[model samples]
Target: MKVLVTGAAGFIGSHVSLYLLERGDEVVGLDNLNDYYDVNLKLDRLKRVEQHKNSYNFSFVKVSVEDKEAMENLFEEHKFDKVVHLAAQAGVRYSLENPHAYIDANIVGFMNILEGCRHNQVKHLVYASSSSVYGANESMPFSVHDNVDHPVSLYAASKKANELMAHTYSHLFNLPTTGLRFFTVYGPWGRPDMALFLFTKAILEDKPIKVFNYGNHKRDFTYIDDIVEGIIRTLDHTAEANPEWSGKDPDPGTSKAPWRVYNIGNQSPVQLMEYIETLEDSLGKKAEKELLPLQMGDVPDTYADVEALVKDVDYRPQTTIQTGIGNFVDWYKDYFKVK
Candidate 1:
């Protein structure tokens, strides 16, 4: 199968691309190599993908998803069998600082992807959504069935908008679209902006790490491998219209059209302090902690109810925090030459 993976140099995108290539699938990876965090890290991920000992064809293109002309040309040229759209301006607090970035990347970029899939006859379109969409809903174990009308940040709102837009395309064009609301994903080659990476770096450098919400937050941290596995499984499972769906009682997760949404996350939610401690243990260093109130666009906790995903894919994230943190620390030490 020929596939197009946007954000291929990104944390999750790189891993997913590698997985596809190793399985003998032709993959065209695209990324703008933006300076959201570290361009060097993104380049390094691309290098790894290219150097992987895989039998399949793999290529990387430097293209921004927001560019409609480039995206349309690429879609028309490749006629992709499947597309994994993971590119987006990610970060809750950053969204507060630069709202326009979210609009350009998440909203406009996603529109191009939807259009590409619609015109190119893509078999399946699996795009990234976020657990942040469950904002302000004081519900434990966030489920896809739950209504996520209230979003605290523009980032969350953008992701929710992507779902809505995807539904529209699926309804109007009969395109099969699936949105995966990923929980906190962390592992080797993880983004520098993420808490796990920041905490690990700060602790190793003997710098103070900020404890958000006064160390009261709980997150369902899913491992990178598990997330890639879920993505592959869902990509293979083309979405179909839910016959039981009704207009009178609409389910936000599934629709009468060929569209569906599922939460991809570890069922376990770990306290922020516990996560910090795990990182400290992995690094063999203690971090100076500055306990602070939750910043704007932040939530106290996130726990994913992945029952629907488990029922459909017959798989669930099983990586423990200890193991995941250990793997990350090992990778960090090796990648950055941390003595």
Candidate 2:
């Protein structure tokens, strides 16, 4: 299958692209190479993709999803069998500062992708949603079937909007769309803005790391490989209309059309302090600690109910936080040359 993976230079996107290429799929990776974090990291990820000399199934284009015209052109050019839409302006705290970026990238950009998929005869459109959508809900294990009307941050709101937009497209055009609500995805080549990266960096630098919510927060930190695996499984399993779905008691997770949502998480929520301790152990350095109140648009905890995902894909994320953080620390030390 030929796949078009947006945000291919990004942390998850880069990993997904390589996974697809490894599985003998021709992948066209697209990214604007935004400097939201560091363009150098994005370039380095792209370089890693280019380093695969055997399959040569990967190609990248410099483009942003917000540019509707360019996005349409790319879609028109490639008859993508599957689309993994992973690109977005992704930071809860940052969203509070810059809401328009979320609107443009997460909202407008997603609109363009839905349009493209609707018109281009794409088979399956698997997009990234977030655990942040479970904002303000103190549910022990967050499920896709739960109502997500309340979003704490603009980033979460945009993700919820993407799910709605995809549902609309699926209902209107019969597009097979699946939204994966990822929970705290982390691993090698991870985003610098994410908690794992920040904790690793601070520990290596011997700087104090801010433990949010007084270190009472818990997160279902998922590994990148697990996410990529789930994505690949979902991409192959096209969405189908739930025949039993009724408007009288509609399920939020499934639509009458070919649309579905699943939580791609490990189903294991670890304490923030435990995560810090794991990093400290991995790096052989104790991090200076500063307990801080939870910031705006931030949730105290995130625990994903991945039963549906497992039932659908016959797979569950197996990487523990310790292993995941250890891999990340090793990668960080090797990548940054932290002696």
Candidate 3:
């Protein structure tokens, strides 16, 4: 299978590309390598994938998805069996600042992806959605069946729009589109903007980490390995039109067309402070905390209801926060040479 992975230079996208390569699949990696956080870190992830260039099938292209001509040309060149659309302008707080980035990448870019898949006869299109779509919803465990019309940030709004756009394509052209609403994904080679990476860096430098929501927040912190596993499983299992679905009382998760959505998460939400403590233990350093109110476009808690994912793909994110943090700390030490 020739798999096209957008955002292949990103933290999760790079890992997904490697996993596909290892499983005897050809991969065409694409990314703009924009400095959303740090371009060097993104390139470092690409370097790790390049190490497997000998046996595994892998090719990389430096292009943004927003470029309609480049994206259409790439699709015309390679009739990809499957596409993992992981590229997008990611970051909640950053969305508050540069809202146009979200529009260009998440909105316009995703539209291009849907268009390419429609015309090129792609088999499956699996794109990355986020748990941030559960904005302002106080549901105990965020479910795909729940209404997600209220997104606090433009980033979240763009992701929600992606799901809708995918559904429209699936319905109109009968494209198989699956949207995975990912929780807080973290591990080795994570984005510097993410909480774990920032907290770890701050703690190591004896800097005060801003404890958002006064450390009262809880997150379903998912490991990269688990995320990759779920993605592979989903890619293999292309979505199908639900037989029992009806328009009268429509199911939010499944559609009459081959469109679907699922929550990819640990199912267990951990406190923000507890995660910091785990990181501290891993690095043998205590973080100086500066408690602060939650920033705009931020949610107080995020707990994913992954029952649908578990039932469909046997996707159970089993990495404990302690173990995952330890693995990340080891990688950080090796990557940065922190003595």
Candidate 4:
């Protein structure tokens, strides 16, 4: 199969592309390489993907999904069997500073992806959605069937809008679309803006890490390998219309069309402080914590209910925080040539 992976230079996208390439799939990776966090890191990730021992028939293109002409041309040229749309302006706090970035990247970019998939007869469209969509719900274990109409940030709103847009395309064009609401995904080659990366870098450098929510926040910190596995499984298991779907009591996670949403998380929530402690243990160092109130567009906790994903894919993300942190630390030290 030929797969199109947008944001292929990104944290999860790079891993996903490598996984596909290893599985003997022809992969066309695309990324604009924007300076969201670090363009050098993005380039390094792509370089790693290119240099992977298992990589074969893998090629990358520098393109932005927001450009309709470029996207159209690429879709027309490749005619990809499947698309993993992971490109978006990521970060809740950053969305507050530059809301238009979210509009341009998450909204307009996703529009182009949907259009490309629709026109090119793509078999499956698997896109990245965020757990932040469950904003203000206060649910213990966030379920896919629950209402997600209230998003706290423009980033979350854009993701919710993507789900709605996917449903529309699924209903009208018979597109098989699946949205995976990812929790706090962390691992090797992770985003510098993410908690694990930031915390690890700060702690290693003897800098004080800002403990948000006063270290009270709990997150379902999922490993990247587990996420990539779930993505591959979901991509293989193309979404189908739910026979039992009812409009009277509609489920937000599924539709009568070939559309579905799943929360890909570890299911086990770890406290913020506990996560930091795990990282400290991994690095053989202690972090100087500066406890602070939670920032705007931030949630106190996130626990994903992945029962739907388990039932459908027969898989669950079981990577422990300790193990995940250890792997990340090893990667960080090796990548940065730190002692």
- The best-first sequence of candidates by lDDT reads 4, 1, 3, 2
Q: Write the per-residue lDDT of candidate 2 for residues 1-339, one digit (tens) a residue.
A: 999999999999999888887778999999999889999999999998888753478888999999999999999999898899999998999998899999999999999999999889999999999999999888779999999999999999999999999999999999999999999999999989888888888877778888889999988989999999999999999999999999999899987899999999999899988888888888888899999998988888899999988888898998998888888888888999987
Query: lDDT of each structure?
Result: 0.94, 0.91, 0.92, 0.95
lDDT of 2: 0.91
Error of 4 at 141 (Å): 0.6
Kindly provide the TM-score of model 2 when superposed on the true structure, using C-alpha atoms: 0.98
- Lowest summed-lDDT stretch of 10 residues in model 4? 52-61
Error of 4 at 65 (Å): 0.3
lDDT at 313 for candidate 4?
91
Give the higher-lDDT candidate: 2 or 3. Answer: 3
- Per-residue lDDT tens digits for candidate 4, residues 1-339, read 999999999999999999998888999999999998889999999999999876768989999999999999999999999999999999999998999999999999999999999999999999999999999999789999999989999899999999999999999999999999999999999999998989989988899999988999999999999999999999999999999999999988898999999999999999998898888889999999999999999999999999999999999999998888899999999999999
Model 2 root-mean-square deviation: 0.9
Model 3 score (lDDT): 0.92
Taking all chains together, each candidate's TM-score versus the true structure is 0.99, 0.98, 0.98, 0.99
Give the Cα error of residue 175 in candidate 2, in Å.
0.3
lDDT of 2 at 86: 97
* Minimal lDDT window, size 10, model 3: 47-56
Better of 1 and 2 by lDDT: 1
